[model samples]
Target chain A: MLEKGRISNIQMEFIMVPTIIATGVLSIPSIAGRFARHDMWMTPIIGSVIGFITVFIVWKLHQLYPKMTPIQYSEKILGKVGGKLFSFVIVFFYIHNTGIVIRQYSDFITGNVLKQTPAIIFSITILFVSALAVRGGIEVIARSAVICTTIFMITSLALLLLIKDLELGYMLPLLENGWLPVLKGSFIHNAWFSEFFLLAFIFPFVHHSAKKGLKSGMKTCLYVMLILFYVHFFVLTMLGVSSVNQFYPVYSVVRAIRVFGFFENFEVIITASWVLGNFVKVSVFLYVASLGLAQLFNLSDYRLIVFPLSLLLFLFSFWDIPNVVVLVDYMTKIQPFYFVSVQTVLPLFLLLIALARKKRSDHV
Target chain B: MIGEWSIILLVQVLIWMIVLFEWKNLKKASKANKITFASILILSMILSFAKLEYLPGPITLLHYIFGPWGWFME
Candidate 1:
């Protein structure tokens, strides 16, 4: 088989940044606000536990099997049937997860931007673009993410303009609901932080010679949590408890920007960058799903399945998500456990199995 | 209703065009790949035309299975 591709630690780090941050910056602030209220900013400290554990686990798994994805290496640790079953389940999970990601993107865009353009179009079009990017493979996606992250960061300058609205007093009532709700708020981002498992699919492709990948990956996860923490802080300080009523709090914050009564509607600028970041996010998940499918089926070329997988994704997303009300409900109530089970606990289980087996292939 | 059907027809045409353009390479796909490809393509086409009535949402599925276990998924 031809070498799939390789990406430097920096590119991997860049990819991780948007993949982790894109969802939280859009969806989490409001959800976190609902639970933690003024203490929402404090949730990231607990969120960091998820980030550290996930990245650390994936990194250890990668160290154990240097040249193989979890899909490929599971067969080595467990015998054929068990490994194949594990890979099959996780591959399907990745595919299903990608569908939900696209659904979120479709919901956000259709609800906020297009308004009337039926979500089918956005879902299909974005999935098509992501499929095209995935066809170019990981190097292309990583490089594209680098460019998008640069734009994404620049657009976040809108956050700076929001500083005038900051009120420290808004956070004065912190812990008004006690520490319990703050911990509950952490559960939302905890799932997001464990999404580092998505990177395990690409970990073998990472240029980790200098051990820079682990540091960079951890930093990337830290960056996402910190950014989410800051965004939550920013939103809380500006909108206070009112932010919890918003579907997209960061966008609401950006929409609130009015410098000297001249600069307004800066949200569009942030949306464009955010939408671009989402493209990378969806493409990465799409790539993982397609690549996993191809590998699972023993196909010669992953690209052959990208189109079909993407089409199926659109169909599944449209049929499955129905509306944002249900979507958000699922995210808060159900997705955290679902994600943690597949992304964190399952991988940890595999690691423990490999350890008990005492495989000679492992390296620290 | 005609407009919606026409939209579906146009999208199907566009999908086929891309498939045709990529067919030179896709022709090398194995029987399993071809069958899987064809099945997914047909599924999407059928879904495009379906009225979306009575389709259970993803959460509904999760809720149904997990609800009995006290996992309502809200």
Candidate 2:
């Protein structure tokens, strides 16, 4: 069981920021560009607005039951049966999601950094390491995030060394398609932005004195969003909108960075930072799945399930997708709603019900 | 994508073994709890396999019900 004294608000902020930023930073610019074209930078701002509304909804629910997770409050709002069913849905979703995320990071590493290496090796290695962290529980994961976030920030600053190659003309003719495309792209990005809903699971577990945890969380999310926008803007300005068509523009940008000839090939550093971020992201999801499973069974311990669940996740990561294209298609087309609903909508619904029930109980 | 079928099968068996090891505690679970757990497991299994096929028939049905909410990227 995770003890209540384990993590503080600052630690929680560290955990949430890197996990949300890591994978999205790599792929979002290109994905958003697919819809928004030259206007990709605006999508994050619009997405942030939508994201904050969703966060407000989640925060309102937390205010209703300041010390209960969605799982605990669901049972309070709905009866045991309904709540368990809802929790089961959420847990299963996390399991599937965790597998896909693990696969994504593995595929990315193998595709860019270790082209000759079999992706399954990377997949299993990452899952193995993450499973160990999950077993150590959320406190270890948060501390790991703090260290990884510092490293990530340092690597992000390294991109500044490439400013000489940047071309401001790439971001010109702003909103060539008008604001409509930007708004449409925001909806796609909104799904990505709503990932902060994971905070709902960890909120009740934070040490109570961690003042303004939600505010810190939202601020961290906005900071990450700002960083993402700036990174994408820098990549666009450096590589141009046409060059951004490549699958991993950020990696390409890193490869393009050449300082004094001796400082070239910075993709290695970006990949290393990304690997750490992916570790935190995967471990958080895996921990959530394990915790949800433990609660579903009313078990006293979640550690027993960690290794077994990770083994299953490793298998599921390679289950049937034969290539990267299929994986990308599934991620962009089919899976966004799965990511959004269980993580965002269902929690909001549970929060509303919990709030109403709290009011009713207080009236009595 | 390169894992041997045997490895995949072995991992699945290991998961079942762990679940079975925990089954004694599950015995005390209410009927509703059992139903929910079973449904979740079954649904996740179905979706996992559906990804193997090109279309993922059940997910398509879900997408259809959700009704063309910007997934097409047009």
Candidate 3:
């Protein structure tokens, strides 16, 4: 095996939670609100249903191939040529997704915190940091996640302070436009939630039993859903349907917090938490992409490709995503279907083929 | 323009630094590993010299394939 380090189930949860929510919390509410309006809080609950199904599918795949990642097993399930082609597509999907994730992070920093600095600097710095973590392997990523996620969750709690300013009446007449808008809003989130399929890469390295890892994965999805719901609740109640107008509704709500009419400017706390969250997020994606590539070509080690892949990711962040307008447009329009198909739908197909093949072999 | 040239230069400098830092490990690495490393590095370096923002990259390609589905949100 290319990866020798093993992580416990809880550490896996810590890493995966930030991986999904790090970017989702900032960007999702506004996008969902654009469709769901006052019913935006319902979007994440609906979206997380995909998370549950993805977790079940990934677990079944893991049970069938106890010692392999999706990259390795896809080769066994398909013929050599077909498996190589499919694995390449999967690796490229992650490479592009990770690039976009970095773009999204740098966009937030430039658009919000550091307007004076060029965005590429933030992208380079974060990718460099994440590259170092990826070089250290999954255990290092897991350990840093434990610290980063704790800080992220605590700072996330600061959003609760906005409850006082929220107009409870804003959430009334829920589902007034019916479920179609809410379901439309949930579409983008399903893309994010289906990211649970990333667990396939980590499953072979997890130290605990498959059942425990499965439970933790489900709990992590619930935690992500609740966190999104909480952020949406604040954004919806405070800004109402107007939250859809702001690019970063969660950041706006965080900026509105005041404890004694004098204390405020909590945006820094949330930004710091986002930076920490993005750190773990990028590291996990980088690790998965590099590991998948190593497995694809039958390399002796994945660590060798980490820095080169990071540079490729840097190049990708600049690949036609010139500004926030283009980035958000891509996220809303193309990404939901693109990400869901590659991450969720493809895996479902692979699982079916693998299961059918297994039945044939057993009968023989 | 100086800005564009500088970006290209910066990318080269960054690539060189990575190669330099990993030279020891690269020396010990197998032929396949070395080839993979050099190929990805060269590809990114070549890509960095181009006007990437103008390039019809993966996003544009994905838009072509999945662009129709976007109407659901519209």
Candidate 4:
């Protein structure tokens, strides 16, 4: 077992913001457009409420068990068997989630950039590299996140360079459909925001004062929300409501970049930045999955599980869903519930139970 | 196109190098643990080559069963 090290609040914040912001930024404008129509920018602001609620639940849980991971405290809250079962479900979900993320990334690359390369090849390559990072443990992962996130932020801003091509008319008639679309968009946004549930697994590992930890995590969530808002807004302005018709509006917007002739096809740069960002994101999930597995089974070494688990993930990525449409449908309609239930609802339930038990015992 | 055989060979050599590096670092890891790790690496290589087409019907069914969670995409 690797010793848990001191990670300042800021470092903890940096670690999470990029992980949440990764591939999601590319898909949001398109996804939000599906429900929010021309009002996609409002989706993120509304969705952030869900993100804030999730952070509060996690913070509350952390408050009860100051330095313990959810995995560590589950047994105490639910009794040993129940806690283990809960931990098992979470571990299972994260492992499956990691594989899908890996698949999504490989599919993206193969579909767009490396057309001739087999997707399994790309998937295995990424899994292999990510496995190496996971083995290095959390500190290395956090440090790399800081570095990659800086680059991600810069490339994200570069999207703004396309402002000359944006049409403000595309954003006209604000809320023309009233609040229905925005509310629906908020549901999708809530699903993405629920990703902050990962902080439950990581917060116990941070070697910061509780107050500082809470502040850093909230700050990180705020930063990511800002980035997501800007990315979705720009994509809508650049491509119009028709942008929703495309699968990856951000990527399309990047492709639309045509400054002075020489700056055409900045999509390559966007792709590079996205790939790196997804790398950190995927690696973090993989790490969480491994850590959860280790804690559940009481394993002494996580490194030993890395290769086999990654191989299983590689295989899982190649399975089922014959084409892209089904994949997109699955992502938009089904994923929100999955993310919100386990990451949001379940954690909130556990936090409430833990708090009540703590209060009862305190009174006694 | 990189020939299928070449990709296989390249992946195998890389796996062998990784095994050698690990072996050097922890000389005392049980032989069984070492063998298990090596076997998994070999299995991954073999699975990598089986091509998407060669997967058996049962395996494909199993794949679908575990694949596709609704919350993954949009």
Ranking by TM-score: 3, 1, 2, 4
Weakest lDDT window of 10 consecutive positions for candidate 4 chain A: A315-324
For candidate 4, lDDT tens digit of each residue in A147-215? Answer: 887787787777877878878888889999999888878778787789988888778778764676667
lDDT of 2 by residue, A185-226 (tens): 666677667888778778777776235766876787788778
Report lDDT (Cα) of residue A100, candidate 1: 82
- The clash count of every prediction, one per candidate, is 0, 0, 0, 6
Task: State candidate 3's TM-score.
Answer: 0.98
- lDDT tens per residue, model 3, A195-309: 9999999989998637686888899899999988988988899888888998998888888899999988889878988899999999999999999999998999999999999
Superposition TM-score, candidate 1 onto the true structure? 0.93
- Kindly list the per-residue Cα lDDT of model 1 for residues A316-339, writing each as its tens digit: 675655568877887887777777
TM-score of each: 0.93, 0.87, 0.98, 0.86
How many clashes in candidate 3?
A: 0
Q: iRMS for all predictions? A: 3.4, 5.7, 1.6, 6.4
Candidate 4 C-alpha error for residue B25, in Å: 7.9
Q: How accurate is candidate 1 locally (lDDT)?
A: 0.80
Q: What DockQ values do the models have?
A: 0.42, 0.20, 0.74, 0.17
Error of 2 at A349 (Å): 2.2
Candidate 3 lDDT at A120 equals 83
